[model samples]
Target: MGHKLRLLWAAYRKIVYVYLLLVLLPACALLYVYFHKASAELERQVAESMLRAVEQVRINVDYRLSIVLEVSDSLILNELLYDNLAEPASGYRFDQVMEQRNLASLIKSLKGHDILGIKLYVPDDKLYAREHVHFFGLSEARAQPWYGDVMARSGAAYWVSTRPQLYGAAGEVQALSLARLIRDPQRFERVIGIMEILVPETNYAPILSGAEFADDAEAMYILDRAGRIVSHSGASRIGERLLPQPQFAEMTSGRSGILRFAHRGEPYLAIYDTLQQNGWKTVSFVPARAISRPDWATSFASPLVLILSFLLLFILAAFLVFAYVTDGMVARLRQITSRLRLRGAETVGERIANRRGVILRLEQSVAHMLTTHEQLVADHYETRMKEREAQLRALQAQINPHFLYNALDTINWMALTRGASDISRMLNTLAQYFRLTLSKGRDLVTVEDELNLARAYLDIQQHRFDNFTFELELDPAVRECRIPKLTVQPLVENAVLHGIQRKEGHTGRLLVHAYASGAGYAIRVRDDGAGMPAEQAERLTSGLQGAPGPAPAGYGLYNVMERLRIYTHGRCRMQLDSAPDVGTTVTIFVDRLPER
Candidate 1:
């Protein structure tokens, strides 16, 4: 593994090198290999097809030669002919003369129509060499170039690639012929005469023409067992031996198959097969370039190479730009991280950002922490405010749990000490007062109803105190909001009992009003009667509990303040303003969002 890493770095140390090493290079190599393999495969297939084509021609050529062999076979078995032709004729007689001359004509008239010439050669004095007439004596037969191999073939015939010009027909480029020895039938080992059959080499041309391969640039040829070129695309190379070439070495090694070899510095594909019956072989040869990458292939590949090169360069450039940008970003991130550590941001962002692999998410974490801190602080202050309001609520408490029993005990003691008549009178007054204030035990009343109560009380008091006048003003919009039943009535009663009733003359004026304040409502009790100074009014409105002075005078003002503080959760306030010869206004203000 260590070695592999080192090798990788060595090969791909730079971005461009890495791209070339891993991507472009492999692709180019694969393309090059694929092109060659595809060409080779195509050539192999075409070569096999051409092999089949040549094999077919070999078959037809063999079939045509079989006809001559048949005629030769019949005459070779004739004992009477062998007996007469074995010895030179003593004199020309009608029987011997006709037999010798008619022998050539008889073989020529055989069933095979493609057979163009047939020659008979016998060692007899009566015959002279007349090659055109197809009758040759011993001198003509012994003078032929292929006379040795033909004589050596005992029973089987020898196929000649080219016949001597003396024995060829007119206009023949190459004459394919068969030469055979006529052995005495009884003593078949003794040679008596020779028979040669001739035909134009073009007899096999149709086989190649019908195939789908080139007949000009590429070639197919046949070689006999003697390694003689029996048939070729052109006849000039008929007698040449291609079997000795290094290219044909592998072809001769096996009965059939294909091989690749170089010719004239160019590669070629050759497929070969042997004629099983005759030991002859046919080879089909094709240039490798013709099958693999043709002329059009090179033309098309030029543009493709340019496009691939451009794409490779573009990719390399993109990688370089990315590296440069990310490097700068990493440096900036390191600086930010260093600053954050020194400033002590709780490093919560670092943990979160590290998990997600992003620095911006670190900022999100910091923001989240700040928001959480703010929320905690708000909650802390809210709790303290709630505690303060709870203390105020305690001040709003009225009767204690043991007050009723304690009061009954005090009444029993009072009955013992005072007269029964005095105790009975006090009980009756308290009972009537409680019944009027309870109002069937309901705790809440609309401002309109409460104002009506204040007006009714003032109506009764007006007869007792003829010196006072009272006015009631209530906003219809504020009348729908409910408050404690006695909230506005007591304030009005304080104005009447203390301020308006105590005034010296009939100049005392009382105003009881309620109006909208924010989302809640406000009630004001103003009296234009004789009012006290600010210090005296503050003394009266100071407080009911924890007082260093005497008990508070205005129970009505004290009760309203306590109720507003408790019910509104310290959201409401009551202020009393009074000056010498000036009116005193008591206002109970509420905010929109009530604690309840």
Candidate 2:
């Protein structure tokens, strides 16, 4: 028996090792390949999303400046200002004191949200400075930095905010100024002066808002042609030249698109585009790891770990079963050979040849020892009885409760202290989910309790999903309102399974919003998933009671509707609004509930 056991153990080891090689290596390789693909795809989506946001910022900036451009276009149409600055205004022909009033009126006509100050540089400086209007000499225009660019523009307009002296209100007053070269066509198109219109920094600064990607750490900026920060969420950064960045060369290369590079030894993604109106770059800078790790990578890790863990358990189980079966067969061979030796049978067939396989020799020896049919039948019956007894014990073990809840509590504690807080949190949430679900078998539950159950379910799902996120909003007044116990959970499940999971590429959002309406309340479950058509959405809201067979599509929704109808005495109705590729929104409008 001992020798036979050694043979079985050797074969068991071979099979186990071979099976592991077959399963583990391939699974790991496939996981690596798929993970690479998913990471690349996720990074692309993040880049595209960031690019669109930055592009929107650019459009906003362009739109604001275009409004100012319109004011410039309207100001250029004023012939009186051009005539006033054409040359020294006739002191006898026009009121010298009223020339300031005349210029101020021109500034007022051109004034809107776009203009704060208008400085006209005249060669013959006769007029003094006013609140909105200022007259300077050709030398004054030469002193300004953007003056050359405005002159180089020839007949076109130019916008400059690169330096402080460019502003009429010293350097302290920061504003985007539009400069246009005023020319006299009647005087052979000779240069008259430079027209400068000032727009306060506060105007477009708020349009940058607080928009960011991934988190607040990710920054969005409107940069000038000189690489200086024009408009930023942080006001202090305005006019400051952005510190030398590695990608600054690539970004300034004038090809507006996405690029990736490392900053400070860490990877970063830069999505930049040039604004057409101002020729400024809108850069949305984000950390590369921030865009990838928290999303799908987390989703992959947990599932991969669970699968590998199960594979290990399976390998162990395989070896255990192999050992168990081999022990029984080898023991039977020993019993047969011992009995034959006592009965004087010819040494239980030929002496086991080492040349033949161990299994083959054992088989032949057992055949000779069991020559009598009666002894073999007796051994078989005994072996069957042993197996039956073992199965009965295993059955009892499986059915026994063994204080499952207490075991879970022990596991929760073990996970918590060992720095597996995530596991502990998931286990606690799961336990709470079950407790809330049962609710002591109560049918009606407060809106708050129902939302808690939904939240618990979503929290657990969040672990498995990397690209998925959800929000739960409950108005304080609606928390006490009672609704069906399991209503919200099923809806959330439907949204996650049908909506978020089915969504292709990019993050999925599930929102459960509950609030008081008029005399009653409303519950909204929305998902940015692969939304269905209006007809399909309408069909989904219909209860399945009259259907011929099981309709898997609408079953969960139908149950919720029926439960709500019965619980609220027909005071509630569910409505669905959905559009293809846009999203789905399911609203439960609850009428006034009767007092118990």
Every model's TM-score: 0.45, 0.50
lDDT of each: 0.63, 0.71
Q: Write the per-residue lDDT of candidate 1 for residues 1-596, one digit (tens) a residue.
A: 78965764564469657666777777777667755564455555555555555555555555555555556655554444465676656566675667665665565556266666677787656544444466778667888877998877775778776543444435444677778887764466777778777766677655544542553442777777656676776666777876556555567788888787787788776767776446777676667666544433543365457657666777767655555555597876788889888988866556422121122322343464466456556655654455444433333332222343356557756775776855554444443333334444345556676777676667656755667788889887786676766677677766776666566764688888888888787888899866787777777666533232343336656766666655566677777888766667888787643333
Lowest lDDT 10-residue stretch of candidate 1? 352-361
Off by over 4 Å in 2: 1-16, 91-94, 129-133, 165-171, 216-218, 240-246, 252-255, 328-596
Looking at model 2, residue 129 earns an lDDT score of 34
Q: Candidate 1: deviation at residue 10, Å?
A: 25
